[model samples]
Target: MVSYAAENQLVHLLYARGYAVMRAPRSGRVGLPTPDLVAIRGKKVLVIECKSRKTGFTVEREQLEQLKEWKRRTGGAAYIAWKRTRLGLFLKLADVIKNKGNVGKKFAEEYGIKIKNEE
Candidate 1:
């Protein structure tokens, strides 16, 4: 799957969970740090980065740092989701991952909801 497809799936999941979501446009070529999906529930907001995984790959440190900066600046949650797994597994794992005191937890605490993985 492509990155956009993963992002769309994540947006759909967020919407299903009662969060308002928006997708970043693909037509722009500016040097802005556009998040894949932006979701909001109550006072919480999330900036998500979507990834397509095919095994033997994982989130990198630089990307994690970038997400952390985004979360800090926006006071929203930041997450990365792999789009190669079952939706149920994704959400279930998301619950656990989001609870960890890291980027996910920071975002969740700010937004009052969990930041789930897309896959």
Candidate 2:
């Protein structure tokens, strides 16, 4: 069971960025390969898988593939949001896919987008 803290934190952050965010209810148990959170601003849509950890995390291959498919079908951007410390870091889904769904801290540091308080 994933904690609500990570998802809620992301929701607030996206809201501050002028995006409307929606979190999946019982996301893990949904059994449908849906993303943890979806945020939209104007014509841009973001499908994100949220992870909160001290170091790194791994997304299942099946989940990664489904996320890719969802992006392809919806024309939305996909990302892995990792909260390692105080703020969340956004990593491109394409990068994760290339790495086989494994996100290490080093990889995140190299590729993660640091979200600022002001966009």
Candidate 3:
């Protein structure tokens, strides 16, 4: 399916986990680094940049930077959800990925949270 579909599904999963979520306005037209998803559960807040890549997931420097700025400004968390294979893997915005490299289970263990079982 398309990346937008992945984003929508991710939104639902976040809601199920008790985070109030909203899909940001389309970024290309908005001309801003708005994250794909914004979620808050009680005192916790997150800005998520979602990706659905066939190859390893890679985050744009600008995207990650903006997410970092958001977290810095809000004193909350920022994450990148690499929805590569329904694993629902996530990484901290500060985490490094060298040139399109995929995150390993260690990153998953540290930052990832499964939203759905493998399908």
Every candidate's lDDT? 0.57, 0.84, 0.71
lDDT of 2 by residue, 7-117 (tens): 787799899989999888563555677888889999999998888888677889987998898798779999988887686789999999898888888998888999775
How many Å off is the CA of 72 in candidate 3? Answer: 0.9
Higher-lDDT candidate of 1 and 2: 2
Evaluated at residue 101, the lDDT of candidate 1 is 24
Q: How close is candidate 2 to the true structure, as a TM-score?
A: 0.89
lDDT of 3 by residue, 29-89 (tens): 4776677788999989988877776554445666667887888876888877877664677
2-118 in candidate 1: lDDT tens per residue? 466666767787898889998866466276666666789999988776656544234455555666777778888666654544431122224424444233333423433334554
- Badly placed stretches (over 4 Å) of model 3 are 25-29, 97-113, 117-119
Better of 1 and 2 by TM-score: 2
Q: 2 or 3, which is superior by TM-score?
A: 2
Rank ordering of all candidates by lDDT, starting from the highest: 2, 3, 1
Which ranges of candidate 2 are over 4 A from the true structure?
27-30
Model 3, 101: alpha-carbon shift in Å? 7.9
**Alpha carbon lDDT at 93, candidate 1:** 22
Candidates in order, TM-scores: namely 0.61, 0.89, 0.76
